[model samples]
Target chain A: MALNIKPLSDRVVIEPAAAETKTASGIYIPETAKEKPQKGTVVAVGKGNKDHDMTVKVGDEVLYGKYAGTELKLEGKDYLIMREDDILAIV
Target chain B: MALNIKPLSDRVVIEPAAAETKTASGIYIPETAKEKPQKGTVVAVGKGNKDHDMTVKVGDEVLYGKYAGTELKLEGKDYLIMREDDILAIV
Candidate 1:
C-alpha cells in the first residue's frame, strides 16, 4: 500500500533510518541510548515551485542535516517532513 | 557609486543595518560589544531560477535570519550575500 501522506510544495516525506541499537564494538545499547538518524528513504515528494525543482524520487536514500525537518507520525510509523534544500545529498 | 557586487541565481546582496551603539538606558556600547543586526537594505537581487521568482527588488528593507548569508566586503563596506529564501519579510 502507498503512503497516504502528501507533502506540500518543495517538501518531502522521508522514512528515517532506524536508530542504532548497538555499538561498533558489539555492545548492546538501550533504545533510549540511541541518537536520531540522519539518513532516510524518500517516500513522497512535492511538485516544486518555479524557482526550485524536485530532484529526488520515491525510494531514493538521502542524507540530510542533523537538525533538518519536522517530525511526523502516521500509522504508528515515524517520518520527517522537510524541504528538498534541507537534504544534503543522495546516498 | 553603484555597488559592484552581483549575486548569482536566487541570491541577493544586502547592506546590514548599523549595530546599535546605545542601550535603552542610554548607556554607550562599544563597537566590539554589539550583536550583528538582522535588518538590512537589499542592494542587489538575483534573477531567480525556474522554480522561484524574485520577490524583492533593490532598495527594499528586509528582515533575515539571525545567522543567514555570507559576509562580503566591497569598497571597504560590509555586505551579506544570501538567497531570497533567507529573507523573512520586507519592511
Candidate 2:
C-alpha cells in the first residue's frame, strides 16, 4: 500500500531512493562516502499552489539534485520533496 | 574571494558543505555510503522570485534537507540550494 498524501498547493512529497552503499567495483562503501542520489519515487503530491501552477502529479518519478528536497522522517522512514519548483526534472 | 552569484527571484544560492567521509570511529567511508548533509554556506542570494517575496540575503548560512536543492556542477565542484522556501532553516 502507498502513502495517502495530499500536497498543499504546489507541494509534492517524494519517496527518496535508499542510497546505495556499494560501488561498480563491488566495494562496500560506508555511510560517510556516498553522494546523494538525484532520483526518487513520487509518493504523494499536493494540489498546485496559488503561484506557479503545479506541473507534477502523484506517482510520477522525478529526478532532482543530490541535495534537493526537505528531509522529513515519517513512520521511522525519511522522505522528502516539496513544491514543484524544487523539482528540477521529471523522469 | 567568492563566486559572484545573484539568485533569481526567491532563489538562494547555497554552497553545500562537502560531505564528510569519515565517521567518529575513524572509519573511512566511500562515495556510496554517506548521508547528505543539510548544512551549507550561502554563496549568493537571489533577489527573490516575483510570487514569493524575497526573505534571505547574500552571505546567509542556511540549513536544508539532505535531498534539498537542484544540483549544479560549477568549476568542477558540486553545489546546490534554491529558493527561500526550499531552505528549511537558516543557521
Candidate 3:
C-alpha cells in the first residue's frame, strides 16, 4: 500500500502485525490480555539524519520495543510511526 | 569535576541537577513526592554519528525527560547517560 504521509528525520512508518485473538491451543484471549505486538513490517523509512544511517529498508520485518512509536491510522489501517532506533532488530 | 568516561555514538554524559528536597516555604518534601529533575549539564558528548551533528556543547545546560537516561555513579557523584535525542532542549 502506498503511504500518504512521509516521516521526517530518522522516523519510519511501520505496519504492525495484527494482534492475536486466540492462543495456539485455540483458547480465546481477552482484550486486556492482548499485548501490543513488537513486530512489524517496515512500510516507509526516512532519510536518516547526519548522525545515523538507515539500516532497515522497506519490507524488512523488525522487532521493536513494546511501547515504542506513535499510533495512527491511514485509510482505516493502523500504523506506527517511530524513530528507527526504536526498532530493536530486523527479523 | 572531570569525567573519566567518554560517550559514544550520539550519547552524552550529563550531571543531573540535584533533586529538590524541600518546598519553597521550607517544608520538607517526602521522598515519594520528589520528582526527578529534568535539567542537567552536559559533561561529555559523543562525536556525531554519520546522520546527525552534536547540537550541544560541554557545560551547556539542557532539559531532558524526567525518566530519560541510564543512571551511573562516578567519583561519588551521580550521572546520567543518554542519547542526545532524549534531551528536549538546551537552556
Candidate 4:
C-alpha cells in the first residue's frame, strides 16, 4: 500500500533502497555486493522554510545518507523521513 | 592538505565517499562497480541553530546523499558541504 504522505515544513518524502546497480566505471554489481547509495527518488516534497529556501520537488532524484534521515516503512517499502536540510543534492 | 574548517551555524563538514562495501547478503563488490552511498563521517560539526536543536558532533558516522549536499574537494579528497539538517542518521 503506497502512502499519500504530504511532508510538512521543509521535509521531504523519499522512497529508500532504490539504488543504481552500477558505478561510474560501468561495472555490474550484484545485489549481494552493492553498497547502499545515498540516493533516492523524491516522492513528495514540502514547502520552503522561512529561513532557508527550498529548491527540490517531487520526482526529483536525490542523494542522501543511509543513516541520515529517519527511516519509516509503509506497506513493506522503506522510506525516509527527513527535513529539507538533510537533503544533500538533487540529481 | 586537509583543511581545518570551522563550520558556521549548523553546518556540518563531512568526509564524503567513505561507505560500507557490502550488501546484506555479504557480496564482495569492487570499487569499480560500487554505488555511491549517502554515508559519510562527520569531520567537523557546527553549533545548533536558534530554532532547531542540534544533536550530532564530530567523528560521528552519518548518512546522506550523493546529490543531497553541496560538494567540495580538499587536496583531492571529496567532501560534502551540508547543513546539520541534511544529516539523517548517526552511525
Candidate 5:
C-alpha cells in the first residue's frame, strides 16, 4: 500500500477486494465465472472538487459500480482510480 | 424529449450528441467507424446526495467519459442516465 499514489480533486484510490471463489452452497466457482469485485477499501482521497466535498476517507470500505474506475497496477498490486461519485455506498 | 423521466440522487438525464459521420478532412466516415459521442446536454438532474451537492443543471452542455452512463430509449429517442460525477466538465 506504499506505492505513493495520489488522486486529484474528487478522485480516490482503492484497493479492491478479492473476488469470491466459491458460492454460498460451497460449490467451487471457476476463475472465469467469478464476478469482478465491486467493493474496496479506500487508500487515498483527494480534496473536494469545486462543488463536491470529500466525505469518504481512507480505510473506509466502499461499494462502487461494476464498471466504475480505471484499473492500474503498482508494485505488483492492483488498484482502481475513480471519482467519488462513482462510489455507490460507504460500507 | 418529454418522456417524463426523472433521475434520483446525483443522477442526471442527458441527450447524447449524434455520432460524427464525416472526418475532419471532409472524408465520409462510415457509420461503423464513428466514435461514440461523449458530449451531451443535460435534460434533468437529481438532488444531491447527503455529502454531495448538485452542481450541474438542466440545459448545461457537458463532457463525459466515453463509456459513462446507461443508455435507455424513450419516445423513440435515446437518453443517458449517469451520476453527476460522470460529467467531466461543463461546456
Candidate 6:
C-alpha cells in the first residue's frame, strides 16, 4: 500500500477486486471464461479538474465499467490508472 | 447518426475522434503504430443513477482515457459504450 505514484487531474489508481476463482456451485471456473471483475478499491486519488470535483477517496470500493482504464504494474502488483469519470459508482 | 440504440443508467455511446493518419510533421503513420484517439462526441446518454446525476448531454465532445469503453458495431458503424465516468472532461 506504499506506492509513490500520485494521480493527477482526476486520475485514480485502483487495486482491482480479485478475480473469481469458483462458481456459486463450487465448480472451478477456467480463466478464459471468467468474467473480469469490475469492482476495485481506490488506492490513490487526484485533484478535481476545473469544472468537476472528485467524489471518491482512498479506500472506497468502486464499480467501474468493464474494460475501463489502462492496466499497470507497480512492484509486481497490478493496478489500474483511469480518469475519475471511468468510475461508475462508489459502493 | 440515426441509430436507435439508447444507453441506460449512465451508460453512453460515443463516436470516437478520428485516428491520426499523419503525424504533425506530415509523415504518414502506419496503422499499427497509430495511437488511439481519446476524444469523442457523445451520441447518447443515460439517466443518472441514485448517487449521481448525468452531467453530460447529447452532442457534447469529451476526452476519455486511452483504453476506455467497449467497442461495438452498430449498423456497420463503430461506436463505444461506456459509463459516464469513462468520460474525463468536456471540451
lDDT of each: 0.72, 0.60, 0.71, 0.62, 0.71, 0.71
Docking class of 1: incorrect
Candidate 4 lDDT by residue in tens digits, A24-86: 445342354346557677776755556767788777777675567666443445677687778
Docking class of 3: incorrect
RMSD of 4: 12.9
Q: Write model 5 residue lDDT over A17-84, tens digit each, in one string.
A: 77763433453323553467877789878676667898898998777887898664434467777889
Off by over 4 Å in 6: A1-91, B21-33
Q: In model 5 chain B, which range of ten residues has the least summed lDDT? A: B21-30
Give the Å error, residue A83, model 2: 1.3
What DockQ does each candidate score versus the true complex, computed on alpha carbons?
Answer: 0.04, 0.04, 0.04, 0.03, 0.02, 0.03
lDDT of 3 by residue, A1-91 (tens): 5554545557788998666644344534235435777777898886677667899999887778878986644455677778899999876
lDDT of 3 by residue, B9-91 (tens): 88999998666533222322223324676666799999978766777789976656667899989889899999988765444
Worst 10 residues of 6 chain A by lDDT: A21-30
lDDT of 5: 0.71
TM-score of 5: 0.46
DockQ of 5: 0.02
Task: Report the number of the highest-lDDT candidate.
Answer: 1
Candidate 6, residues B13-83: lDDT per residue as tens digits?
A: 99876765332223222243246776667888888678556777888766566678999898887889999
* lDDT by residue for model 4 (B1-91), tens: 3368877787888886444443232322223323665656678777767775555667766555445677778777788878866764543
TM per candidate, chain B: 0.82, 0.70, 0.80, 0.72, 0.79, 0.79
Who is ahead in DockQ, 2 or 5?
Answer: 2
TM-score of chain A of each: 0.82, 0.70, 0.80, 0.71, 0.80, 0.80
Off by over 4 Å in 1: A1-91, B21-34
Task: Give, for candidate 1 chain B, the lowest lDDT window spanning 10 residues.
Answer: B21-30
